[model samples]
Target chain A: MKRRNLLATAAMGLLLASGGAFAQGMDKVKACFVYVGPIGDGGWTFQHHQGALAVQEAYGDKVEIQWQENVPEGADAERVLTQMALGGCNIIFTTSFGYMDATNAIAAKFPDVKFEHATGYKREHPNVSTYNARFYEGRAVQGHIAGKMTKTNKIGYIASFPIPEVIMGINSYYLHAKKANPNVELSIVWAFTWFDPAKEADAAKALIDQGVDVIASHTDSTAPLAEAAKTNGAVIGFGQASDMAIPEYMPTPRVSSIIDNWAPYYVKRVGELMDGTYAQVDSWAGIKEGEVEIGMITDAVPEEVKAEAEAMRDAIAAGTYHPFTGPINKQDGSPWLAEGATAPDGDLLGMNFYVEGIVGDIPQ
Target chain B: MDFGGINPVILIATLMASAVPILLAALGETVVERAGVLNLGVEGMMVIGALGGFIVAVQTGSPVLGFIGGALAGAVLSLIFAALTQVFLANQVATGLALTLFGLGVSSLGGQGYNGIKPPPTEQLLPDALADLPVVGPIFFGHDWVVYFSIAMTAVLWWVLKATRVGLIIRAVGESHEAAHALGYKVNRIRLMCIAFGGAMAGMGGAYVSLARVPQWVDGITAGAGWIALAIVVFASWRPWRVLIGAYLFGGITVLQLNLQVAGSVIPVEYLSMAPYLITILVLVIMSAGRKANGAPAALGQNFHASR
Candidate 1:
């Protein structure tokens, strides 16, 4: 089979070299990835690269993936996109918020190319689409674990900006923790960036000094985990992206992680292209869709706590429960949603009000 | 009316701290410009410093040593600009831009391994009691030593530029490099030293963000702060005291807007996020309004050739 595939590839290569244009309807799937950070950064971009590698291994000659990491947020983003487009990338995935305007602009310029931007709202042309994993849903599980495991009743949340996305994660985590253990209190610190290991660590230290036991961060670094590990046996953290594990620096992140399964999506798109049904899509997948997965429960987690967390996870998957179901109150004790009124997707995405269990202002 | 809610005191403090990166870059540029040389490679020098300080601090476990490492890295990176502008007599602006592009790539590669790791803890200098004092506490006492030194450097710079004989020589060099060259001042040497110094300070400012403020190893961590600082120098009309005001104002806008977002105000966080940069641009536009707004040295961008 391998020999036959190689021969076919050789034939195709020869035909293409002769400029004969062999087969119709997507002869090759030219895919590109744009990273906000360096691929070797051992964080967010690393994980995305892992997914890209998985696709390359799976598809072989059928797929050609090219990636440019550390492309800045503005005009540079447009330049990289144009370069990728001119290089014959049929599908380009830009992975940053600052890349939103640039991606849209480039997508308009190259009408045939499919542009997918992660965590951006402005999706214009039929060629452009937006996709984001339900990271907040996973944060709920992390909060649940923190609530059950923390003896101090104080869980520290290191956030990246006060944007609705980060705010939503903070609220979801707090809501779940508050549900599991009523005494659980949240100590939040906004680090103001997607990646800054030092500030993330300092925020962790500052929270620990103030008597918080568990640490959670939305920033794209393992600084919180490393900081948590230094405290002998007390502190614990969950992996942010599935890529957070740096074995030499720290042990496994205790709670589960939210993994982005771009493979299935990528593969499906490639399949569509092969069948002449390729189209742009704005996809937001959660636990129900398997994009967000809960990993092995670490030994640091107590048995009872693990059982409760597993139950919650199961309920979420079964559609019998939601992390942000109602009867919740704002931090100021005002009723946010009446009983049984699950917070809608719109509210979740534009979350401005904090729930009852949190301390400190969202800060104007 | 609601200036109290805006927390002007905290705003001012943040602005001052924010100005450090710009002040460092500007001070170095001030010297270079004073010597009739324009080294526009501030951004490159800064990024090199960002990685250098981050790597050293992580390795040495000392923020002070990390800062020194940052300055050295800046100086090293500046030599590229120095070589191009001085020896090759390349177009200063174009060469500086190339330095930035090259620095971005080199620093990304140099900083690869250091990414996603937590920075070593920084030690605060002020005594706990003093650090806790009211409005003055955070503004005056709570900053790391670098903040104080930045302020002190501004004063020293003002004195050097206006009150000293050496200042006269530097000013003379900027005004007429040919004349300074005829008067036997080592034209290229002085400009080289000033360019290197500017690079070092810019690097130190970059280090402060990585080591003191944000203190993380992220790609493009300087995040256009170098450009903003460059603009601040012009906005301040090249005055040392005004540099402090400009830096603090920009910083204050950044911190206040973030604070407002956290406070759950009605304003969109996006606007707040962009407010500082937009304000800086606006300030620059306003500063350039009057005729004779070119407060800069007449020979700022001109190359000084010993033979010419």
Candidate 2:
């Protein structure tokens, strides 16, 4: 027993030495990912898996990539994260807003295992990091197009959750739509899930029945476009998380899309680990960093509207204009930003209110 | 025409469409339970049906044929459960759960390369002229054939179960299989046939989601509708007409909740969000405590083995 104790101590010392070495230069890096939806979802999870695949292509044999899909964000995530950490995942990326707490909790347990959480702002431990794409930037583009094209002036948003990330998208989309057309009315139905195709379809159908001609969804699925297809040119919608440019609904219901581009950030972080320059970082990149892209504006949009939307996109990409630029007000008519004043990062990160002129309370 | 921004006609129309899937699934379960079997694999069978229906619809370019293919797929999958619980004398509950896991595995494996593909549009049965008539037209007409078929099935199921000789044999086998065996009735054989009917119905219900409602293939597309169907069976006390009422009640509240939110009603979204589950639980509890629950098959969930 005494010899076993001594041997265990010696093994612990060796592990610590290797962990220290791992903190520095490493010959090989194993990057793992946990996704909230199936990779075949053709939307959010599909795109994140694409980013994981990009890491493999970028580093080849130097990096080993592993991923688990359809991981629900809660205790299940903690279990999966702990397993991956014990399995020697050098850096684990939890790719969903709901995983904020689990990522931080698991990060604390495994101080040597680096953690990167997407679209969340909880970095309780030094080993945990947070990164997110400014998806609202893409929403701004879709809103402008939705506002310009809707004949009914009634638009709808199928919200996944009441989280700040989704709330921010709602406000941005509605703000831009309200700016383009003062008469536009935005209807929101919280489906309360990230990727249930059947529920998403019901929400979209509800909106269509209520005469909403322009639709946008915060959830991950193409069923919204499929439901929009049933309208046969009456209603139109934009693809969320992926360029749903499928031949079935393209140029019609899927007039445009917001593609989440995580490859650059993913490849960059994996490369940083390889070069011994890794540090806990908070990244919030948008169109400028190529993290958020507006998919092609189909010919269905009027030429002038398409051109104007493209101009806004370029301005956003060039850092000359902010999507949440001034003259904005809280839902109750309280002033949020003065004219010529853009929203600060702090306010957008924890946004919880609907902008003015968009009626209805945000579900708490 | 509107109550709290919800057009009653349109709300009812959407409710009918939404309820059809669960209605069909629950209706099938009603038959299975009456025949003295409880297969909890409705979810498994439904998802496989979704995949089968979507693939066939996309391949053959015929939505009608797609539903048939879905039924065939679900029936084939349920046969595994039927064989296990009936012939092999496995525990119905455990095998049903395993069947769900197996179906999920088979679907994800089979669903490769079918993502993002849309099935052909399901044709609405009625003429547009009839469908365009105000209130009544939108509320009662213009749905795909499944809606009418489900309602027809409900009525037919009620008639057959309450008044027919075949229904008597199934119930006899369910109430006392030993007595059924003494009467020279093939107990396991009758249960097998009933399980197949349940599977075929569940498959069609699942096909409705992929072929008409969502009209696209996604892994696990049924998403617990089968479990809800099981719950509805308990809620309805295994009766056909009550299953319809239970399905529509759940469906109505589901559609109304979203419409209420869209209308920006004074009701809280959080409360509305929980309303469906609350009502379902409330009904299930009330029915189980009531006298109607005496309708349960005496020999439900039991395996039959031949004896001297």
Candidate 3:
């Protein structure tokens, strides 16, 4: 009788343990993604969706993902976010600068929900966090490639908005290009749109017509590459995003890409929440983290040129290099830094002026 | 610009393809104006059709279904314009403006999911060799069937307006609704049908933008082509042949500018980029200032109610 009683107790304990495991497995965390552009824009937001896909894959059984694309930066965004919160979204990401206010307004109303905004500065409340990438670092890589490859000493840059982010990239690209080819000149073309293939193509062609032998674009599209392909033997271009992964479109797109790896951040936060260590945080990662990557340099790049670019990339990865180092000047020919005096993070983050090697006004 | 390195055949082909959107929209508007309803909401209608067709096509993976869905979506949205102007008798201008704002919001809401992905491949009508011929091929046989349909539509519209008895009735209603009512014609009914047809065409144009041209969906995809089409109606003096010329001219400028950039023009990128829109505006101004400026249908933009 005693042995039988002990066996029954063991069986009951096993049943309870199994039930607890099942309950844990069924517990759900709701997550939502709001995008500024369509998922097929083949650029910024598309890559973010890819990161979200990674999160979905990793947390297959534990989380639910909902996404809204082409969300404008106004009251409609606020309404959609409210719907997300009401729908039981425990974590939400609003991706765009215009979404900053809406995110904060919604965050204040839903204290239980955690909010994250991409490429935005405002981080209010205990639940709000801001995140962005060091795209300028990748721009430095592009600058290096354009500088070494251009035979005309003229490089064209197709830009979107003249915002700090874009300006920082232009300055970074020109600084590095000028370092390698002292005589290199950058002609600027602003398309003023995030994703218009027609506009992007037009801007790229404008640059090509002006005798620019190499092209780089801050706008999202392979239109610039399409423009480059039309140019003569010396013309080359880089991919803004990996959307131009076609083999023939390489070399200029040589450096891989600065991928926005939001998966690690998302998963890490979720893990922290499970462990009772979650906290609101704002973060930025550059070459140190794996967010920025170097794509394969094709046979088009000369051996010595590849070696020099690789050395610079290595130094950047090892924290020994800075793209905007000493002896730089603003477009007005005023010395921005005394010889050998590097620019500070504060200045670089707020950069609005063209560097010495760049020509053309930041068209109003 | 460097068309020297680029194939002339390829350049011309791209230009004709670009003309498809404008051609579709303008042809639709020509019918609308023929019935004496001046809709400034073509842009709005086109965008909604773009979003609707794109969403359906992406969901069903059928371009035909996308086009049909787009036409229905457009017709429904136009019914709102019809109801306001027909039933409520609201100011046509204000109602059209409100319709645009409403369509933009609705499409933005409906089009959230299908962004950024490449569209499913569509079937082509012509073979490569025929498509690759020089001037004759591109201007005639190289286009998608829609291009041919648009051309055929222009001829059909011209015949319908000039030769058909139904055309006489529509023109009669447009010119003097009270007189047409005395003659036993339902002016409102005819105008309503014309408005719906206009909406469908605009929607089809929007679908073309999503399905054939860009072959992808995005927010604000139509941009401002609708507004341009509305303007072109007046610029073309409301003639079918003129509408075709205006569309190709607008389309050609856009294509030519891009080609110049590709061929390597020395112009500033900003200025060259604005070339298409600037040229369109210039043409409109020049045309409008001419002695025949008053060639628009006399009853255009005027709502008629024949209570007598």
Candidate 4:
């Protein structure tokens, strides 16, 4: 029995060595995904799952997709990635910022396998690639509409942790809102959580009680929108990761949304892998690349305001407008960008401070 | 710097609403521990309750029936732990942990078709006159029925434990199952009942979170609230009234920190976010230090076998 097992292992190893041509002349590619939250989270993970489904839909039987949901972003992620690599998965996508270290560590061990980490920065191994969407671009559009629609001139932001990614979104949203309406005052409530609905709702309620008429969030849930709906047109919110404009609360609470369109990128990368042309590239695509999309700006906004927001979206897509173009100053009144100077990608990627108008310090 | 818009009444009202879920779960845990069973599956039971309550609330269009469904779901999940530890003589702690894992998986599975769905609205229990009372009106009278029910359950549990025979028998069994057994009481039977009660309360707590607080269903909707309830039980020192206080204290800190952030307070937001957990630990340490005896039941976590 031991000899027979060893013989079977040898045969499998031979099959793996002969790249496209096997004894049966069939080649198949297995792609696996690791999600930080369950696919039913309705915000972040749910959208990523849709992208994985798109990959299957694009390739038919030539590609196989497997995903393990709710994989925590620590040691457990490493174990899951390792198991997927051992199970003959040719490529794996670790989809969260927290999986940065785990993806790199696992990628080192599985040199022949390709690893993709989303919303992360590190690429310690040659086989590891990182990709992220410019969610701030969508934030810019939401801010434009928020500034115009808020009757109280007070826009509340429900933030999730003080990471650079979240901070960047906050600053972009605040800046655009300030531009659209200089009278807008931004109020931020840092919930320090990615997806706790009750806490998110309480944050929204607190902001609303304090006279915030418009709300924006960098968290992963529809709770803020639901909380806004409770006010009966007195409060409005923008959806964060997905279009959360459910039929019941549509056109009012969720006037617009920032959607993470990962399908095209996922499909393109998988195509590259199938053709043996995949490379370790740092891809940060945004509006122009069709990675980050702005959901419909419903009739809740006035026609002129909607037109302005649409123009900004078109300008962003046409590469004529940059969200960070400014004579902007730091929160402490230090010079950040000169007049009409566009802030570089490096500054935006490592953004940790709020722009001048935003109150309070970014928690270290 | 800008604290002008912060209203004390609204702040306190939000605090009460936030505290109800934890208070209910802690009160249930208080009873279960008083009867000598240490069930670590509160989180599991809570998630199942959240999903179960959400499903029923959506189908029936009644928040009341939704909460009942949540309690029932929680109780049923707890029965698995009771059978494992009480009937089959399994390790209580291990079985409880397994129950939590099972609950999370099953609840997520049950929640598949229910994502992005909103539950029926829960109305304020008090009339406008009472609910609109200056300062105290919003704080004390503007919550849904579950908020009042949680406090009432604490009071009722306190009365029963202090003045009732059933409470004495349950405490006796918790203190020493062998002695309770020699006294001709059914140890496992009483424990089974306590477990079911704990499960029901936890389910209601979870249901309150999904059906009332957020009014929507998402995966892992309970989101570590059950564990907070467990910590609150310990922080309460196994007393019902203290559990109420502990739950509110945590809730108040949570609401206050968010208020501080919105007011542009100078304190770091991370420190503000960590304040509740730190305060809970400090309170627990001080309470444990001041008390001469540990508040835990004598036979807590010890599986009782009839022959042994």
Q: What is the lDDT of residue A265 in candidate 2?
A: 92
TM-score versus the correct structure, for each prediction: 0.77, 0.95, 0.69, 0.96
The per-model DockQ list reads 0.10, 0.69, 0.13, 0.72
Question: How do the residues A243-327 of candidate 3 rate in per-residue lDDT, one tens digit apiece?
Answer: 4455445544323344455667767665555455667887776766866666566677888887887787788888898787878
* Model 2 spans > 4 angstroms off: A1-23, B292-295
**Would candidate 2 be rated incorrect, acceptable, medium or high by CAPRI criteria?**
medium
Poorly placed runs, candidate 3 (over 4 Å):
A1-27, A109-112, A124-126, A227-235, A247-258, A339-341, B1-20, B36-308
What is the fraction of true interface contacts found in candidate 3?
A: 0.11
lDDT of each residue in B1-308, candidate 4, tens digit only: 13455677788899999998889888998899999999999999998998889999999999999999999999999999999889998998899889888998998898887876768899999998999988888988888999999889999999998799998998998989999999999999999999999999999999998898888888887788989998888777788888888898899889888887887777888899999888876776676676756568999999898897
Q: What's the CA error at residue A350 for candidate 4, in Å?
A: 1.2
Error of 4 at A290 (Å): 1.6
Q: Which portions of model 4 show Cα errors greater than 4 Å?
A: A1-26, B1-5
Per-residue alpha-carbon lDDT of candidate 1 for residues B110-154, written as tens digits (9 for 90 to 100): 987776665675655798788788888877887778888888988
Better of 2 and 3 by TM-score: 2
Whole-model Cα lDDT per candidate?
0.75, 0.89, 0.73, 0.88
lDDT of 3 by residue, B61-125 (tens): 88888887777778788988987887667788988988887887788678776554555545456
Chain B of candidate 3 achieves a TM-score of: 0.90
Instruction: State each model's C-alpha RMSD to the native.
Output: 7.0, 2.7, 10.7, 2.6
